[model samples]
Target: MVYTKNKNKNLIGDKVKYARLKNKPKITQNDLLARLAVRGITLEKTAISKIESKTRPVTDKELVAIADALGVSILWLLGRE
Candidate 1:
């Protein structure tokens, strides 16, 4: 049995995008990339855009960095909390 977690249909990208953009001070993808850089994660703005558009899959490490950069919990990013 090969089980996949959050598989292809997960809304994590949308959630990350929302968390990055819908706050008190709306954060742009570039800003998010910069913040992630400070946290030792390197991601491009285009990648972030793809993530927001649901055209890319997010890895666990990337998800963690994104969650930390957005100041949201991983469970929240996964829509589990």
Candidate 2:
């Protein structure tokens, strides 16, 4: 199944956008960094930004943080639900 933005409805992208929209931060990228930092993920703001835009890739652990910050299940991030 295709679960990517443009190509399809990417669960990861959706979850990230949902989480950022929930907080309404100053900048989307900044918000991603804040979320990751709170979870002790320690990634650059650009990295998260790239992930959101689908310009870069995320590791399994990073995906977990993305899921946690978004308050979504990991299975959801994996597009299981």
Per-model TM-score on C-alpha atoms: 0.81, 0.66
Q: What local lDDT does model 1 show for residue 51? A: 83
**Where is the poorest 10-residue window by lDDT in model 2?**
2-11
Q: Output the TM-score of candidate 1.
A: 0.81
Residue range 1-81, candidate 1, lDDT tens digits:
677675454468888878987887999888998988998888765988888777788888888898999989999988899
Which residue pairs clash in candidate 1?
none
Candidate 1 backbone clash number? 0
